[model samples]
Target: MNSNNSVFGQTLAQVHSKFIIVQVLVVIFLCVNLLLIVTFFKNECFYTTTRYILFAVTLLSDSFLFLASDFIFIFNIFRVTMQVSLCSVSCIIVGLYLIVTPVTLTAMTLERYVAICMPLRHAELCSTHSSVHVILVIHGLSSVPYAVIFITFFASASLDFYYQYRTCSVEIFFLYKWQDHVKSAVFQFYFLIMCLIIMLCYFKIMKVARTASGDDKISSRKGLRTVTLHAFQLLLCLIQFWYPLITSSLIHIDFTDLQHVRFFCYIMFNLAPRCLSPLIYGLRDEMFLHALRRCLSCGLYETK
Candidate 1:
């Protein structure tokens, strides 16, 4: 009995530690995202430009994702159960942002491809008006997958399911075993298409870089690196979707060991991907960094 008590205490401490760590990371990223967003609004050039506009949308999606996921994480840590209806709302919001992030990343990559590979048509193809249409299309596409899942939920779930209190998770949508397989297959196909598009953009940009000179060459090379970062970010997002398969393979392991693996994967795949937007855009892009620095300096001067 004494040994069991000691083990329980240790597990409690670990849970507290994990909570604190997650909160700290979320706060840091949210603060950074807010600062970059402010800088984007302060500069007319950034707000008007197609590339920066897409970057801003990516940041906005990341911000919303961080908030929604963090809410779920905290609830799960405390083992709080809510009505299925409430949980469904939170889960749906999280799902939308998750879908939006990768789609926006793909759009950003295509924007770069046009800017470098078709310089003469870049303005006409990627104009501010066109970007608004692109964003609408992205959100529209992101909504379709969730709409199908919600339809399944409503069709399969009895009325009692809505009033029942349960811990929120993606699993709530899986009203039947077949739904899980369908979800997995749909995601697999979606990601395969996205992966192909990014790869194609990279190869096209590479060709442009090889034969180009001076400013055009430099632009194409930078675009290549940017697309590579997008691909890496997409891979991280993809892993979260496949997380169930990863954990299922470890089912034979001790329960505690399995929990530890899940925690690590949550941090690495879920939290880490949301943190990369600032690194890819705010710090890596020379123009944006310059604008951000100038905005910060001006703010500091005004404060003084």
Candidate 2:
């Protein structure tokens, strides 16, 4: 019995350490995202550009996603249960933002395509007002699946379901086994559409990159690289969709291996993709980088 107790203690220690490492990484990324967000606002130049606007939306949504999901993660670690309604709200927010990131990446790719391929109409077509409208549409569409699922659950479940306490995870919201299949279908459908959109944008940008001259060619090439990074980030999101299946298979093979796989997936596929947006835009864009530095210096000066 003491041997079993020792094994349990070791397992608990390992789990806590893993949770701390993940939490630290998320906090670091969140701080970087917040800094970039402040930089965006400080630079009035970003206000008029559609790309910057969309990027700001990505940062905002991703920040919220990290916060909400991390709360759930920490709660799971401590075995903290909450009211079903509250947990559902948190899970819905988490789901909404997960869909938003990839969809926004797709939109950003399309924006680049328009900027490079159709330079003349880019300003008019991809204006600030239009970008905001696109953002609203993205959120609206992303909310549909989760909203439908929740509505179905509430409609069918007893009123006691609302009052009941439960651990907050996506599984708690699942009303039926069919919901899993529906989720897989939604993820697959989204992946297909996003893949096609990014690929089309990439090829279009590539053609422009080959034919254009001097500054236009340089701009086209830059846009091509940006779209490629977006595609990679979207791929990470796609991998996250399959993470559960991967972990589930690992279960029968070895429980210890399953935990490792889960941790690896959570970091690489989940948190790392969220980290890319700032790296892509904040570090890569010279203008944004300059503005970020300026903001940071000013912040330090004020503090001093």
Candidate 3:
């Protein structure tokens, strides 16, 4: 019995240590993202109207993500009100922003595709006013489904206060019943459809890249690199953020079967995406890197 108690104590200490590390990493990442956003905006002379709009959307989405993560980290550190009330609102906001960022990314990808692949007709197709209108419509349309889900889930769950030293989550509504199967099927179908669309876009892009002549090679290669990196980042986010959550919601797995180490892994999976996104863009985009370098140089000169 004494040996078993010692082992249990050691396990709990390890879990606590892991949680603290995760929280620190999350804070560092959020700060870095903020700095990147500031640097991006400061260096721009006159951003295209569409690019400005997209940046605004990205900023809003990332800000919400940062806030949600920070709140979770704080709640984990301090045993705050464990009622799901605060978290429900945060979850809804995060969900809406989560959907918004991807929709913006898809629009940005299409914009790049059109600009590069159909340069002759780009002026007619993607004017500033048209781009603004399209962005507004996309934001409104993509957000509706998530808003509906949030409302439905909030109404379905009974509000009872509970205390626990962990971040709050929306109660998995379809964990055991037939509804679990239905939800999982619908989610998988949606993900599959999105994957199909992304793959189709990539195929066309590759085809265009292959046919481009000597002078176009450099630009084509750059664009392809950008798209490839963006796709990889999105893939990482989808796998890390959505996969486990969806699986847990779908499968009625026994808690006893889950290793405690998995809990830290799950937290890392969620936190890493947000931290990595700005880093990916900074590293991949020559324009962004140039601008960042210029800004840093100017700052150092001013300090001198």
Candidate 4:
């Protein structure tokens, strides 16, 4: 018993250390995002109340996930009951945010698509009022799957476990036989449909851009860059996060069987996208690059 207890203690210590590292990285990512938001708001060109609201919503959702994960990590240290509750709430919020963000991304893509591919219709179609309404509708649609998952999971009383150092996962739903098949099918279907929509929209935009002529060289380049950034984002999204989770689900393997590998992968996957996003935007967005330089120069001037 003493030997076993010592081994467990060592394992917990290692896991706790990893969790602390992830927390620190998450904080850094949030700070970067906050800076971007401030820079965005300060720029009059980018100031639209609708965009501000969307930014706020995304930040709030991301913060919830961060906080919830932090709580779970801290709670693990003491083996408290509250961890389970935090896990449930965190899972629901994270799941909802996951769904909502893709919709936002899709809308943002369409916004860029219109600005490049259909410049004449851009202002009329993507006015502030229209964008706000579209955002609301997108969020409403996204909430449906999360709501179903939350209700079903909670109602079934399957959220009782508070595993130490384990991140809350979608695979927890699969423990129930009915939820297992239902969620698997739903996820597969949704992923396929989303991929198809994204492909179709992108192809159409590219086709339109190719036919147009004149000083659209800049616009065409921007359009392609936006699509590439989004593609990279999607690649990271799938390979790092969704792919691992999906693999775990499809294999029907015991979570404990590959526990450490999954945890490490999750940490790397989640952190990579957050860090990569800012870098990609900085590289691809001339406006953002200009803003960054201006901010840096202003800071230097103030210091001097």
Candidate 5:
């Protein structure tokens, strides 16, 4: 596959370089994520709130997604052909991430909504244990559709040849035409429903926030800013990924011709949330940052 550009019909040197850059970024992201995890676990305060728990969950899920999907970059960097079993497992992991992420995000938004709009009910509705339960339930429920797709896939696909391109989607290369339709429809429908839930929750949150006045006003404004940031992140996901993903059916570009497009989209959409979630969501809390600083400083002094 590393020979002349006959198969892909384009110069692959640039593509190979891009893969290296992305993999380097992924390594950096993994390190920072690990640091935050260790810091959070040490502090009792971090686990006390539902929001923090949800933020931690998002960070963990996003990290796993990057690790699962971007192994292709490593293989591509070495100019190695991926093994069939590894490729199949990679496909399943990536699909699971795609479903799990939006659902978790939806839960995050709802948590924020209740915390802001319905402060009295927030404690009851959004507890650490309940948040963890919701995460488990979301993962469990979303697995059903993907489960059906995966079972049907193995039964139908010949699996004699696996894709050499950066795209690891099994739906595109394997499975019957109708099965592909079922897969895409499941993703789109779930995303649409979850997207609506997020927007509605935030909309109600913003309205309630603006109506507050006096001393409560300051807290409301902070909530407004935080919720807006969440919305912005979702908007980024929509533009970078969901829009292209939805419109993917419109143009039928061959994978080889559009490898660069898919490559960058995966970076921006798939990997970016993992990279940014810790900073944007987790570290935004002043308490978490202070705890992290103290932990690092204590460790530094001990090392000295």
Candidate 6:
């Protein structure tokens, strides 16, 4: 009995140590994303446009998504019970952020297409005000489904005041119910359509990139690179968010059977984009890179 207890104690200590390390890594990644956003603030026209504003919104939403998910994660780790309504609202916000990201990327792709394929009309068509309104509309549209379902389902169903799982997602407490399945389907379908649109836009942009004017060639090449990055990023989002949800639904596989794999996928789906997007988007632009380099030279990033 003493030997068994000793082994159990050692195992518990190892698990606790791993948990703390994971938490620290989470905070560090979140901070790196924040730093990426900060680098965008500079004396340049890139930060002035509505397009860049929309890009910044994506960065902020990515960070906010991780913050919400990790907040629930930490609370659950500590066994902190929260009211059902509050948890619903918080998770809904996180869901909206996840949805808004791909929608924003779709908009960005469309903007690039117009700038490259319809150059004469690009200015009036892709104004800053219009971009802001599009983002607002995305937020409204993404929230509607979650808000409607949360109210509709919670009204009729019995639920505990405290969270039943670490994720604070309705699918956790609600299980394999209709609403849970429907919500996942809606998000997956939305991302699928967004992925198609992004791909189509990039295809047209690629054509324009090949046949370009002497003056337009540089800008065309830049657009080509940016859209290609967007396509890969969208594909990653599809794989991370859409595939797991769809595969799980279709196979009805026991996720618990592969605990480590599920957790790694979960962390990737939640946090990888937050770290990757800043680098992908920022580094793809020569101007942003020059600006970042200048900031580094001038000590804008100096430790104060």
Leading candidate by TM-score: 1
**Candidate that would win on lDDT:** 1
Error of 4 at 195 (Å): 1.2
Ranking the candidates on TM-score from highest down gives 1, 2, 5, 6, 3, 4
Residues 108-170, model 2: lDDT tens digits = 999999999998999899988898899899999778767767776777778889899887777
Flag clash pairs in model 6: none
Against the unseen true structure, what C-alpha lDDT does each candidate score? 0.86, 0.85, 0.60, 0.62, 0.69, 0.69
Residue-pair clashes, model 4: 0
How well does model 4 score by local distance difference test?
Answer: 0.62
- Model 1: weakest 10-residue lDDT segment is 295-304
Tens digits of lDDT, candidate 4, 161-276:
54433444666544477775566565566666656666766887777668767768657766777766665665554443255355656476664445556556556554455455
State which candidate, 2 or 5, has the greater TM-score: 2
Clashes (backbone N, CA, C under 3 Å), per candidate, total 0, 0, 0, 0, 0, 0
List, residue by residue over 139-219, the lDDT tens digit for candidate 1.
998877677778888899999889998878877778797877777777777788888999999999999999999988887
lDDT of 4 at 206: 79
Q: List the residue pairs that clash in candidate 3.
A: none
Off by over 4 Å in 4: 1-13, 49-60, 73-86, 158-175, 238-257, 296-304
Q: Against the hidden reference, what TM-scores do the models get?
A: 0.95, 0.93, 0.78, 0.78, 0.83, 0.81
**Can you list the residue pairs that collide in candidate 1?**
none
Better model by lDDT, 3 or 4? 4
Model 2 residue 46 CA deviation in Å: 0.4
